[model samples]
Target: MASATEGAGLSVDEESPVSQKREERLRKFRELHFKRNEARKLNHQEVVEEDKRMKLPANWEAKKARLEWELQVDEKKKDCVARGEDYDRVKLLEISAEDAERWERKKKRRNPDPGFSGYAEAQLRQYQRLTRQIQPDMENYARQREECGEDFHPTSNSLIHGTHVPTKEGIDRMVEDVEKQIAKRSKYSRRRAYNDDADIDYINERNAKFNKKAERFYGKYTAEIKQNLERGTAV
Candidate 1:
């Protein structure tokens, strides 16, 4: 039986200088790793505290109420539009003095002329156009009749006829314009992806690009296993 001192001596003798250096390196690595881990933990804690300090405090309840109010109003407007009803602007909350004044000014701007609207102005424009067109033709006809005498009768020969036929170039230009409009519409049209399998082609293409990498990894791992087996080493 070996005594304690003798056993200790044998163990120390079995350990080489290289083994001692390896043990020392392991101890230093453990110490370094522990310090690094502690530093990382401390940094993360500091970041969290900094974020907490920087975040501004707000009235969450009030914010939620305001957002909900806006949503409700938007839904109401949509409902009105869907029903083909006129959208009456409704105030959701009281406005500030400045906002109220701005709203009043906007309303006044909608009808710049106090008693007249855009429709009325358009009607007046149509009436003036008709008067100008009819008056000129009537005056010319009256002058012709006066010069020809009252007994003079009008015939188809007296009426001048005009014919306008588009040239081939003009017709081709118009067709090209129509084709451009059709192309523009088609360009902006969206293709619907309405099924789970709609993106299969894209997924397959992406996977194909990575297939070689996957095969290489598999080959590398198998090669390592084969080498280990030949060397009689445990995997």
Candidate 2:
């Protein structure tokens, strides 16, 4: 039977055409995988080099100090958690004066190529102002509830509500905030021709001047109309 099959065209050691095709496919797949891996490594190395060029600290010593300080903060937080205390209360280790100065200098340094514009800066300031205005009150309320939860004893049927009644000052501030926002939006609509890099200060000053002039002209026109009506002038 084996001799007959061999004569017909099938042989075990001669390797079947299907097996040869499978071997070729596998070899091509391995070569493709190796090339992809090499490309990925090269890309990663390029990213590392770019990050190195954008130095956060001038020297290795400053970088080392920053890392050590961060690690110390992490350890402190862990220890606080282990002791069943509030991790937020765990203060991070402060950097040395030299390191602090280095960090501040780095912080103030502007990139040669700026990625953001004045509008972006204004938006960021608005965002920070809003956050600062709202977050502390919210956090205080949350902290109060959390502290209440830490009690082991439950007072049944005690109707206790967290009261965060807005004060008069807060209400006045809210109204002022709304007015300011309306003014800002109105100003933006009126000054639609200004470019992205246009100076906000200059635009504001010009707008203010125009607004004052418009107000004076309107006031005088209204006064003349009232005088004409009282004097029985020709209609």
For each candidate, the alpha-carbon lDDT, in order, equals: 0.70, 0.73
TM-score per model over all chains: 0.20, 0.24
State the lDDT of candidate 2 residue by residue for 56-119, as single tens digits. 5568778888899999879988888889887764442445678878888998795543445789
| Model 2 ranges with Cα > 4 A deviation | 1-9, 13-15, 56-235
Error of 1 at 228 (Å): 97
Candidate 2 lowest-lDDT run of ten? 150-159
Query: Where does the lowest 10-residue lDDT sum fall in candidate 1?
Result: 158-167
Error of 2 at 144 (Å): 99
RMSD of each: 26.4, 25.7
TM-score, candidate 1, is 0.20
